[model samples]
Target: MLKNKLATLLIYLVAVLITVTFICILADIIIHGFSQISWGYLTESPSDAGRAGGIAPIIVSTALIVFLAIIIAAPLGLATAILLTEFAQQKTIFAGFVERCLDVLASVPSIVFGLFGNAFFSLYLGLGFSILSGGLTLACMVLPILIRTAVEGLRATPDDYRFSAAALGITRTTALVHLLLPTAMPAIVAGLILGIGRAMAETAALIFTSGYVDRMPDSVFDSGRSLSIHIYDLSMNVAGGDSKAHAAALVLIVMLLIINAISMGLAKHWQKNRIISNEIII
Candidate 1:
């Protein structure tokens, strides 16, 4: 009993420490950076190599790149998750192999992915330095995360649900579309938020695939600069760029928090609606 109590205390202490550290960091950034933000800063193009211009183009590019990546990855990841959880037997060799590949892939460093994107998407695919190349590279990086999380969510569905559907003569396709997918939506959204956060924060990968052109891109095929790359350039390359960098970082953090909030809100609404529908049917 005493050992168990000590272990619980230790875990609580560690959790508190992590929370406090995050709060401190976030507070510091906001305090130092919030003052630098202004409407003009958000709407105008940068001058003096990011020392004087707003991040309008960078924000637009970031949105397009992350949106493109999710659009490409989400369907592929969902289908793969359904295959693993619904069709393939848990003990099968193919499932095991695929899981192993995902595990290895999730461990790969971002820089390596950047290099691969440059070599394949930029050069081989003739995409050149463009938002499309960056988006595709991020999709590859995000796939493992989306698939694994979705698989877990699907597997967590009570076996009774499946049995009930079978007894009701519901087709597997209908069941997956109407039941399983909705039930697992929360986990899928969580994975998506994480993937978007990573994609938004990425610097090296965008540098190679998207290029550093700060001008507003005419199309996905045009070279663009993401906010992350702009932050990096301002901080490391441009003199007197610290204030702008901090403001950019603060914007990045705020954007992530908003995405997380919106995703959770939608998930909760979905689950609540599902519950209401079931209660009515009964």
Candidate 2:
């Protein structure tokens, strides 16, 4: 009892420490960056290599990269998850090998992924330093996290769900589409939020794959810059760019929060619908 109480206290202490640190960082950004944020700042294009003017073009570039990344990753990740959890024999050697591969991929450094993207997508595939290359690189980086999370979510579903569907003479595909996916929506959304957050925060990968062009991209094939890359350039290369850097960081953080919130909301809504449907069936 005493040891358990001590562990609980320790956990609470760690939680409080993390909360305080995050709050402090946010406060610092708002303090230094709030003055730099304005309608014109968000709408105008940056000048003098991000030391002057605003970040409209950079924002557009970031949005395109992130959008393309998600559009590419989500369906592929979900399909992989379904295949692993629904079709694969869990105790087989092939399943074990696949899991190991995913684990290793998840642990790889982002910079290595950047180099691979530059070598393969940018050079070999002839995508050049463009949004498409960056998006594909981020999709590769995000896949392991999303697949692992979704597989676990599917695995956590009660076997009764499958048995009931089978007993009702429902096909596997129909059951997967209507039952398991909705039940696992929350966990899938959690993975998506994590993947998006990582993609948004990445600077090195974007710099290598997307190139540091702050001009608004006219197409996915056009070279672009991500918000994280902009923040890095401003802080590292531009003199007296602290305010803009802080402002950009704040925007990035806000974008991440918004995505997380929207994902969570959708997950909850889907889960609620699933529950209501189950009740009606009963």
Candidate 3:
């Protein structure tokens, strides 16, 4: 009984410490961020000296990159997950190898992805330093995460559903489309949110592939910088003190929070619906 109590106490202590650390970080960000946030500051664009301009362009560019990256990553990631979970049998050696390879790919660093993007998309593929190239690179960077999450979501669905659909003489494609995908919606949505967040926070990869253009992205072929890259440029290379960088960081944090909140709400709604459906079936 004493040992069990000690172990429980240790777990609670660790949990509290982690919570405290996270709260401290959040407090720091909020304190610093609120100081730099103002109507005039957020609305205007930066001037040549990184002063007098609002962060409008940076916000716009980041949105463009994230939106385009999600558009590209979602279908590919979802399809890959569906294929792996629904079609690929675990008994096959090739399936096992592919799954292991995906796990390895997920562990790769973001900078390496940036380097690969710079070489293949920018130079070899001749896409040049454009938003499309950058988005593609980010898509690849987040693909493994999205795919794995989606696979887990798909796999988490009860096996009985698949068996029932199959027993009803449903085609494999039809069963996946109508049954499995709907059941895995929450997981897929969660993965998409994560992918979007990753795309938003990426800096090194975007720096090399996207270039440091500060204008609005008129097309996918146009060059632009994400919020992360913008913050890096302002903090590192700009002549001013770190004021603009701090403001940009604050904005990025706020945007990420909003996205996360929305994603969480949606996931909860989906989960609730799933529970209701399951109860009804029972």
Candidate 4:
């Protein structure tokens, strides 16, 4: 009992520390950033080498980059996760090999992905430094994370679910499509959300694959700059652009937080409905 209480106290203390840190960081950014966020700043395109005007193009480009990345990554990640959890033998050499591959993949530095994107997608495939190239690069980067989280989610489903399906004479394929997939939706979505966060904030990978164009993208072939890259350009390269960078950082943080909240809410809502529907059907 004494050990249990001590462990509980330690967990609470760690939680408090993390909460306080986040609050402090948010307060600092918002204080410096809120004043810079005007309607014109958000709606007008930047001018005078990023020293004047707004970030309208930047916002649009960032949205497209994130959208493409998600579309490219989610399907591949889900397929891999399903294959590993539902098909592969748990104790087999093949399973062990794949797990090791994921471990190494997750540990690879992001900058290396940028180089690979530049060499392969940008040059070899002739996609050049375009939104499509960037999206594909980010897809590769997000795969490892999604695979890890999705595997956990799939494994979390109770064995009884499979037993019940078997008892009902449901085909394995049908059960997977109708029951297991829906039941695992929340976990899969949670992984996708994390992937979104990583892809959205990624700079190095986009640096090589997504060009530093300040204008809004007209097509998938067009090059674009993301918010994170915009922040880097203003803060590091441009003179007298700190205020705008701060404003962009503030927007990025708020956007991420909002996306996270909405994704989580949707996942939970769908998961609940799926559970209800499955219960009725069974």
Candidate 5:
């Protein structure tokens, strides 16, 4: 009993410490950014000093990139996951090899992706530093993440469901579409949310491929900077350094919070529907 109590105490202490650290960081961000934050700053375009500039362009660009990245990553990732789970036999060497390749892709450094995007898309493909180029580059960066998460989600479904569907003489494709994908929807959505978060926060890849244009994007082929890159530029190039940087940092944090809240709300709603579906199935 004494040992158990000690273990519990240690666990609680660790949890409290982690919570405290997170709260402290959030507080620091809020304190630094609160004074500079206003509706005008959030809505206005870039100013000469970036001090009075709004983050509207950055917000819009970030959203567009994330949307495009999701559009590219979702179908491919979901298809790959479905193929691996439903079609690929466990003993197939090719399946194992493909899975390993995805792991390697996930582990590759972001800087390498940045360089590749700069070379191929920006220079070789002649897309220039445009939203499309940057979006495609970010798509590549998030592809591995989405695919892995989707695979995990697919695998999380019970084998019993697939076996039962097969026993009912359902075609493999039908079983996947009618049973497996629906069962895994929550997890797949989770992966998509994570992918969007990563794409929004990415800086290096966008820096090289997206360009540092302060103007609003009129087309997918137009050059633009995302929120992450905008913050970097403001901090490094803007006069008076720390003040504007702190303000930008604060805005970025708030935007992240807003995104997370929306994602979590959607996830919860999906999870509720999933529960209802599962109840119906049972």
Candidate 6:
């Protein structure tokens, strides 16, 4: 009992410390940077090498990249996860090998993905530095994370659920689509949120694949800038760019928070609906 009490106290302390730190960071960024945000600041294009203009173009580019990446990755990731959890035996050598590969892929440094993006997507593929290339790179980065989370989520579903479905004479594919996917909705949503967050803040990989052009792209093949790259360029290279850097940081943080809030809300709603449906089924 004494040891359990100590462990509980330690967990609480750690949680509080983390909560305080995150709050402090968000507060500091908003307090210092909110003043920089205005109608003109948000609507105007960046000028004078990104030191004097607004971030309208950057916002558009970021949106396009994120949209493209999600569109490319979500279906593929979900399908792969379904295959892993539904078809492959958990104890099998192939399944274990794939999981190990996923773990290693997830642990790879972002900078390495950047270089690979540069070498393959940007150069070999002849896409050059463009939104398409960047989005593809981000899709690659997000794939492992989403697959791992989704596989775990699917695995976490009670086997009784499958057993009951099997007994009902439902096909395996039908059961997967109707029951298992809904049951794993919350975890799948969480993985998507994490993947989006990672894609949003990534600078290095995008910088190599997506050219840092602070303008609206005519097409996916056209070069464009992202918010993360904008922040990096402003803070590291441009003179008198501190305010803009802070403002961009604030915007990025706010975007992530909003995405997380919406995704979590959807997850809760999905779980509630699932519970109601199951209760009705019984």
User: Which candidate comes out best when scored by TM-score?
Assistant: 3
Stretch of 10 with least lDDT, candidate 1? 89-98
lDDT of each: 0.90, 0.89, 0.84, 0.89, 0.83, 0.90
Backbone clash count, each prediction separately: 2, 0, 3, 0, 0, 0
* Clash pairs for candidate 1: 46-53, 47-53
Spell out the clash pairs found in candidate 2.
none
lDDT of 2 by residue, 1-282 (tens): 999999999999999999999999899988888888999999999998888889998888887888788889999899988888898855677777878888999998999999999999999999999999999999999999889889988998888999999999999999999989978878888888888888888888877899999888999999999999999889998899888999999888888889888887877787788689879989
Off by over 4 Å in 4: 1-22, 263-282
Q: Per-residue lDDT for 282 in model 2?
A: 98
User: Model 3 clash pairs?
Assistant: 44-54, 45-53, 45-54
Model 4 lDDT per residue over 179-231, tens place: 89877878888888888899998999899999899998898899999999999
Task: Please give the lDDT score for candidate 3.
Answer: 0.84
Cα error, candidate 1, residue 192 (Å): 1.9
lDDT by residue (76-189, candidate 6, tens digit) is 999989878898865678778877887888887889999999999999999999999999999989999889889989999999989999999999999998999988988988
Q: Which parts of model 3 have CA positions greater than 4 angstroms off?
A: 1-21
lDDT of 5 by residue, 1-282 (tens): 999999999999999999999999888877877877788877899777566677788778888878888898889888888778777856478788878988888877888888988999999999999888888888988888888878888888899988899899999889888888887887788788888889988898888888888788998888888888877887788766556667778877776778788778977898789789889989
At residue 80, candidate 3 shows an lDDT of 77
TM-score of 2: 0.88
Candidate 1 on 19-80: residue-level lDDT in tens? 99999999998987899999998999988899887999989999999999999999999998
How high is the lDDT of residue 33 in model 1?
81
What is the TM-score (0 to 1) of candidate 6?
A: 0.88
